[model samples]
Target: MTDTHCTLDICTPDLVKARLAEAADTLRRLPSARLTAKLTAWPDVVQSAATAYGYEAAQTRPAAPSPEAISRMDETLGWLFWIENDGRRLLWARALGVPWRKLEDLDGRSHVTLKKQHDRLLGEIAQRLAGLPAAMH
Candidate 1:
């Protein structure tokens, strides 16, 4: 059996998962390339046209995240501090919809192992946030 539940002012693996997912979504909703004055003011017509062509390549872009979401995203980013770098990367990558199979090649870990690590890391973070210890859990 594994421990994944905790109460923290509003903390738990479930909430961490939700927050990470929302943070990832918020990140994707951010604005992309911008038309800077320099790019727009290229004196050479050929260069200007080329720049415009590249910008048009993107058929559509998601609307930028709202100010409130961005602020929440900032707070969510701080949650990464509760764990080590590896855990932070794993949680973020998973939240971003990276497949376990894909991560296996990059991380050299089986999906089962990866899943265990992810669950354990999430539990660790939730415990820290709730000010609980492994013994009590």
Candidate 2:
């Protein structure tokens, strides 16, 4: 017998998927030095984003991802820290009903500001999601 407690039925946009793929590819090609920098930097990034977005740290340890889920996420989203610019864009796309690719054309500084907007939006989403019943997870 097998148990699968949850499934994500939502469909992400194609543009969002492509962006995630690119981020993943970039992560894969990073030299060891850059990889180390990312790992060192990511925790602060996640914590800041989570705080800005209002996600309480899991009171208990988070459940480990099943191998299948981990593989699928890596294949789909590259690395899994929650605060990447690409992840923020996907959140914006969901909130604003704009295509993710539109965000890519933005200049670097504008993109950073847009990403901050995305973070705020994601924080709202997190708050709403926290209120939903467990079955909705």
Candidate 3:
């Protein structure tokens, strides 16, 4: 049996928490007018982040939210969550030097995993944005 050792220098849980907190704080300070733009670009930002972190492209096209549905609601939170979760997962995988295939499997097996994280982050960001100036809000 070949003994293979993997050295992982990933950020500690506390560090990750600190980074998330910093991100939330930064988002909170942004003008509300920028919120829509930020939300709209979220998907592409996530895809790029994933690629930057060494996630291989499994599917050329992203999975649609629904097949037969039309006029889907514009859920800004949903968009934010989608971006952050995918990006974070990709980053984590890269930090650990893990195989992209494993990350793809993780993305597939647990649909709600990233969604939950995204929801939490979005809630924080939304709360912050809500406090912005009336014109921007």
Candidate 4:
């Protein structure tokens, strides 16, 4: 496939980055403790609002998140965290124009398996994007 051949309308490198970033922002805004744990496990830094507020405020747990909010956060985790590291590498490699053979060699996966992983990740991300509200897009 050519660099411009994006399968899903929202799967272009820019859209993928935007969607993933929006998802991350949604996760950070959620009030659920469970969702906060999801961010905690993420490699990136997550600044809790309470931390900036002061020590007294940090002691209090956030209120329960609305069901819609929880659903959004869960979807984000599904896309970003459920996939293993190798799957994420395929995404990054493709986005950055790395050769497929090199990725296969680096990750020790066969060509067929690598392609399958790439397609699967794209499909999953596409599905999740579809489920989100149109306003989010």
* lDDT pick, better of 1 and 2: 1
Alpha-carbon lDDT of model 1: 0.76
Query: What lDDT does model 3 reach?
Result: 0.42
Order candidates by TM-score, high to low. 1, 4, 2, 3
User: For candidate 2, lDDT tens digit of each residue in 1-137?
Assistant: 12322224432233333334443444444345764678866355454766778786554433444555545445434222445676555553544445445665653445567666665644544444345565543
| Candidate 2 runs further than 4 Å off | 1-89, 92-109
lDDT of 1 by residue, 1-137 (tens): 12323354556777777777888999888865563545766565555665767854556768778897787677778878878898899999999999999999899989899999999988877767678543332
Candidate with top TM-score is: 1
TM-score of each: 0.71, 0.28, 0.24, 0.42
Better of 1 and 2 by TM-score: 1
Write model 3 residue lDDT over 1-137, tens digit each, in one string: 12111113322333333334433333344446765788877455454776778677564433333321111112222323434565655543433445555655767744355545544544454454445453332
103 in model 3: Cα distance from truth in Å?
10
Q: In model 3, where do residues sit more than 4 Å from their true spots?
A: 1-109
Clashes by residue pair, model 2: 53-123
Better of 3 and 4 by TM-score: 4
